[model samples]
Target: MLNIYKMYSEFLSSNIPYGGQYASVVKLLRSAKREILKLIKTFLEKDEKKPHIGKHFVPPLMDAVLADYARNFPDARESEVLSLFAAIINQYKVAMKDEVPRIFESVFLCTLEMITKNFEDYPEHRLKFFSLLRAIATYCFPALLQLTSEQLKLVMDSVIWAVRHTERNIAGTGIKLLLVFLNNFKKSDFCNQFHQTYFMQIEQEIIAVLTDTFHKPEFEWHVMVLQRLFSLVESGSLTEPLWDASTVPHQYPNNADYVCECTIKLLSSAFPNIMENKDLYGEEAAAKLLRERQRMLLVLGLIAPKMTDS
Candidate 1:
C-alpha cells in the first residue's frame, strides 16, 4: 500500500501525458483504491472492533490518495475525477465516519475552489459540481460548522451564486445545500451569521427574484427558497425584521399585512393561469405551480395572526 501511495504521489509530481503514462498511473491508483475499499468494507460488514482501520488506515489513504487527486488533478477530465471523488466520499461515509470531518475539510475546500474558479470552463459539469457540494453539506456539516467566518462566507456566496444560476438542476441543488445548512444550525445562529455576512443582500435578491418570477414557470426554485425561509420564521430561527415589511415592502405599512396581500395577489394571478393551461403546461409544471402557491398561502396563514389593520 505504501509503495502504491509512493507511486501515485510520484506520478502526480511528474509531467505525465494524459494518454499513456496518465492512464497507467490511474489504473494503478484504481487498483489500490479497490483494495482499500475492500478492507474497509470488510471491517464495516463485520461490525468488528477496528480502531486501526478508522484512525490509522482510512485517514492516511484519504490524505495520501483522495486529497492528492482533489488538490493536484486540476487538468484531469472533470467527470472522471468527480466519479472517483464521489466513490471515495461514499467509502468514507461507510468506513471512516469518524474521519469524515477531517478528510472532508480538505476535499471540500479544494472542490469549492475548483468549482468557483473553473465553472465556466466546464459548464456541462455545473450540476455535478453542485451535487458534490450538496453531498458535502449533507455528510460533513460538522466540518462545515467549524469553518471560519470568512470560509463560511465564501461557501455562502458560492451557494448564492448557484441559486441564481440559469440551470434549474444547479440552482435547485444549490437550494438543497442551503436547506441542509439551515437544518443543521439553529435559525437564529444561522441568521446572525448571515446577517453579519450577506443576509441583507441575499434577502433583497431573493425577494426581487421571487417577485419578478412568481408568475412564471421557472419560479419553482425561488418558491422552494421561500418555503425554507418560512420554515425558519416558523421555527423562530429567523426574526421578523429580517424579512418583514421593513425588509420587503408590500403596499401596506405593516409587515404581516403586506405579506398577506402579496400572497393573495400571487394566488389570484397564478391560479387562473394554472387552471387555464393545466394541460398545456403538463402535470409536472402544473403540480409545481400549485405546490408553490399552496406553500405561499401556508406561509401567509402562519403570519396572518400578527398582521395589524393599519
Candidate 2:
C-alpha cells in the first residue's frame, strides 16, 4: 500500500514531456485514486486493526496534490484533484475535523479564485467545486463548526453564486447543498448565526427561482428548501435563546410572518384573477389553473402557520 502511495505521489509530481502522455497518465491516476479510496473504505469497514490510512495515506496524498501538483501547475489539476478530495472527505470525514479548515483554504478557496472570475470560464471546475462543497457540507459538517465567521460566509456565498448560475447542474448542486446544510446542522450556534446573516437572502432567492419557469425542474427541491426553512422559523429553532448575549435582528422581528405576508401579497398581485372563476377557462386551461393554484396554496400552507405563530 505504501509503495502504491509512493508511486501515486511520484506520478503526481512527474513532468511528462508529451501532452497526450500526460493526459493518459492523469486518467490512470484518477482510476487509481478511486480504487485506493475503495480499499481504504473496505479496510475501515472490516475493522482492520491498524489501518494507517488517515495518517500515512491521506496526508501524503494531500501534500502531493496541494504542494507538489497544485502549486507547480495551478489550475491544471484542480477539477481532477478536487474530485479525489471529495471522495476522501466522504470517506474520512470524522478524522478530518482538524484538517477541514486547511483543506478549505488550499483546495476550496484556491478553486474558487480560479473559476469564479466569470460564469463561463472553468466550467468543469465550477461543477466539481460545488460537488466538493456538497461533500464537505454533507459529511464533514462538524468540521465547518471550526470555521470563523468570514470563512463561513464565503462558503455560503459560493453556494449562492452556484444556485444563481445559468447552468442547471451547477444550480441543482447548489440547491441540494443548501438542503444538506438545512437538514443536517439544525441547532448549532453557527447555524443560527448563518441563518441570521443569509436566511432572508436565501429564502428570497429560492422563492424567485421557484416562481421562474426556467427553474421548473427544480420545483421539488425548491419546495423542500422552503419547507425546511419554514419549519425552522415556525419552531423558533433558529432563534438564539434570550439568555444568550446575542440579540435578534431588529429589522425583522418575526421572519416567518414577514415572509408569509410578502409571499401572499406577491401571489395575489401576480395572480389577481386566481381567486376568481377558473370555470371561465376551457377544461385543459382550467385544470392547469387549478394545478397552479394548488401548488401556490401548498406553499402558502407551509408559510401560514408561521405567520399565525409569530
Candidate 3:
C-alpha cells in the first residue's frame, strides 16, 4: 500500500529538502492511476450531483497520488514512460465528457512545475509536454473540476513560458494553452506579474510578430489577449491596450492612420461615454470621431494641414 499520508505530509512541509524522492512519488502516482480512472468512469456514468466542494479544493487521496508521482520522475525511463503519457492524453481527450480531472491532483500540478523548472534543459520533449498540457482541462476536467485560482495561474505561467517558437504550430499550441488559462484567470495578479516583466516585452517588443500571425486567416487564431483586455475593461481595470496607434508595429507598417483610427475606435468603445463627456477625451477629439465615425479623418485633419503653414 502507498504511504500516501506520509508522502503528502512531506510535500506540504515547507522544509527545503524533505528527503523528497521521485521514485516514491512515481510509485504513488502509478498505484492511484487505476483508481482515478475508475472514479472518473463512475462519475461519467452517474447522474449529476450538486458539486460537493470539500474543505480543501482537492481530496486527500488525489493529493497523495500527485505527491507520490512527483517522486518518480528521477528514474523513469523515456521508453517506459509511454503508458503514463498515453493515459494522461487519453484521459485529457475525454475529460470534458467525464466532467472531472482523470489524473492525480499533485501529479498534474507537479508535472507543470517540472516542465517549467527544466524547460531550458529539455528542448526535445517540449512539444510532447505541451500537447499533454493542452489536453489538461479539455481532456480531463474531473480532477480539474474545482481547480483553485492559484493552481490555474501556475499552469498558465508554466505553459506560457514554455514556447520557444520553433514552429508556428508549436507557438500556437503554447499560446493557445495560455489563452485557456488567461480566459479563466481574469483580474488576477498573473496579468500584473506578466506585465511587470515578460508580457510587456511580448506587447512592447513582439506585437509585430503576434499581430502578423493573427492577420493570416488560415491561422484561425483567437485574438484572446484582446479578449482578456476587453474583459478587464468590462470589469473596469484595463480601458484599452497601451500601444500607441501610430507607432504600433504592423504588417502594413506604412498605414499609421489606420492604426490610429483603430485605436481611437477601440478606446471609444472600451470607455463608455468618452465622446459624450467633454471632460474626458475632449468634446472636439471624441465628438469629431464618435459622431461622424471618421476617426482617421478627424485625427489626420488635426495634424495634417498644420504642415501647410510651415
Scored against the true structure, residue 147 in model 2 reaches a CA lDDT of 83
Q: With candidate 2 superimposed using the best TM-score fit, by how many Å does residue 156's alpha carbon deviate from the native? A: 0.6
Q: For residues 1-310, write the lDDT of model 3, one tens digit per residue.
A: 2354454334434332343556566456444544544454344334243134222222443344444445555323121122334343453355233323444343455455444564354443456556656665445534443557576556545555543353555566776766655554443444544333333333321233344543243133435554554454345443334344576565333223333455576557655577777476566786775565444445756646665354
lDDT of 2 by residue, 1-310 (tens): 6457546655655543234657777667757755765565465445444336667666765665555434534434436566666767766666766777777877777778877788898887788788888988877888887788888888988988887777899889999998888777675556677776777778778888888877777789999998987888787776652222244343555656655765686667767786576456678897897787667667756546655343
Report lDDT per candidate.
Answer: 0.56, 0.71, 0.46
Please state the error at residue 151 of candidate 1 in Å.
Answer: 0.4
Where is model 1 more than 4 Å wrong at Cα? Answer: 17-56, 70-73, 76-101, 123-129, 187-191, 205-218, 234-236, 239-310
Give the lowest summed-lDDT range of ten residues in model 1. 76-85
Candidate 2: regions farther than 4 A off: 1-50, 69-75, 240-253, 262-310
Which of 1 and 2 is the better model by TM-score?
2
The per-prediction CA RMSD against the true structure, in angstroms, equals: 10.8, 9.7, 13.8
Residues 1-310 of candidate 1: C-alpha lDDT, one tens digit per residue: 5456556555644543454646776666656655654554455445444545445655565566555556565543233334444444444553433555564565556666666664365564466666656666666555666667877777788878776665666666776676676666643346545543444455445655566643244476566666765555445544434443355443343334434455556655756776566578587887997777667666656536544231
Candidate 1 vs candidate 2: which has greater lDDT? 2
Model 3 RMSD to the real structure? 13.8
